[model samples]
Target: MTTLPAPLVWTFDGPFERCLADIEDTLRRAIVMVGDVSRVAMLIDLSLPALKQRVDAGEALQPAWGRFLERMARYGLPASPRVRHLRGAGPLATLVIAYRN
Candidate 1:
């Protein structure tokens, strides 16, 4: 069996308010760099309780990731984020943005 190489991952550690801008900037730069790419996956790791609760409540992800999604849409990148709960590191919420060809 052949194992695929890991996708590029960016970590933003800090309060959401403090790190949101950095995350946005990084994502924008990445989208620009990967122009016309065959595929791209942008995964977001959010482990905050507040965010987790909001997601769990079935509230629109817009509250948490609206801005990012909006930006991606502007670039003609539609996002379908799959949320997963990672148990190892305190209730972590993972959003995987998979871009397909």
Candidate 2:
């Protein structure tokens, strides 16, 4: 039996745009550490209210999100990542969990 490494987790609580660079960097590092991108799975948690507010205020999230997906694809991660929005009240928060699947 082989032992797998623990998941890589990252939590972002700020403007979505501001954290893109950091998020990409983290993904890159994770790919390097795991040695196999296909074995990785990602979970993203975003504050519902904050996201609504941004959308209501005419902020476009699709472009940024597209870029993120592109980065993941480039890193050999899955193109279709599972997204679940949970009810919550707080500032913008993005949680990413990457682990061997």
Candidate 3:
């Protein structure tokens, strides 16, 4: 019997607006790297409200995540992003990505 490791998830906790940039940067790198691989298959779970607070704070969520989503879509991979609104939190963000080879 063998065990498989869970997919990689980047957690940039702290502040949404303040940490949005960092999340974008991290996701970009992962997407680029995974896209270049021989077998292009990846999974991402961005279902945390805390992760989206920054963009949801009147920051045009679509444009904010446009590049990364476009890249993932172009690569023909499945990116499941779960975004929601939550009250209370000071500029905290996080990015989580999963890939399978």
Candidate 4:
């Protein structure tokens, strides 16, 4: 029997590009720490209201999100990550992502 490492959780509340950079750095460090990138699984948590606000504010979140996923794929992670939306979280937008094996 093999036990998996604890999941790596990250919270983002800023521009999409910075978020992507942070996530990318986290993934790189995690992969190096685990020494096996293939066993990693990613979970992305997005706020529905926040996303809508971004769109209403004239920010292209959808396309940016898509591009972020594409960047993750380049690191050998899954392009299609599991996502969950939380309601009544508040006005501040937050993106939470978890990587696990």
lDDT of each: 0.51, 0.69, 0.49, 0.63
How would you encode candidate 3's per-residue C-alpha lDDT over 1-101 as one tens digit per residue? 33324455565554433345665566567767665433333433343455555446655555546664554455444444544434545334434455565
TM-score of each: 0.51, 0.71, 0.42, 0.69
What value of lDDT does candidate 3 attain over all alpha carbons?
A: 0.49
Candidate 1 regions with alpha-carbon error over 4 angstroms: 1-6, 48-65, 90-101
The candidate maximizing lDDT is 2
Model 1: lDDT of residue 51: 58
Per-residue lDDT of 26-98 in model 4, one digit per residue for the tens? 7688677666777677666666776666667777766776787787778776455667776655433333334
Q: What is the lDDT of residue 99 in candidate 1?
A: 45
| RMSD of each predicted structure | 6.5, 3.4, 5.9, 4.1
Instruction: Tell me the number of clashing residue pairs for each predicted model.
Output: 0, 0, 5, 0
Error of 4 at 88 (Å): 3.4
Worst 10 residues of 3 by lDDT: 38-47
Give the Å error, residue 62, model 4: 3.9
Quote the RMSD, in angstroms, for model 2.
Answer: 3.4
Report the lDDT tens digits of candidate 1 across residue range 1-101.
43323454565544444355566666566655555433665666666565555457665554446675555556444444334444354423333434443
The positional error of residue 57 in candidate 1, measured at the CA in angstroms, is 20
Shift of residue 55 alpha carbon in model 1, Å: 14
lDDT of 2 by residue, 1-89 (tens): 45545666676656667566677777677766777878777766677987788778787787888888776677666645566686796
Candidate rank order under TM-score:
2, 4, 1, 3
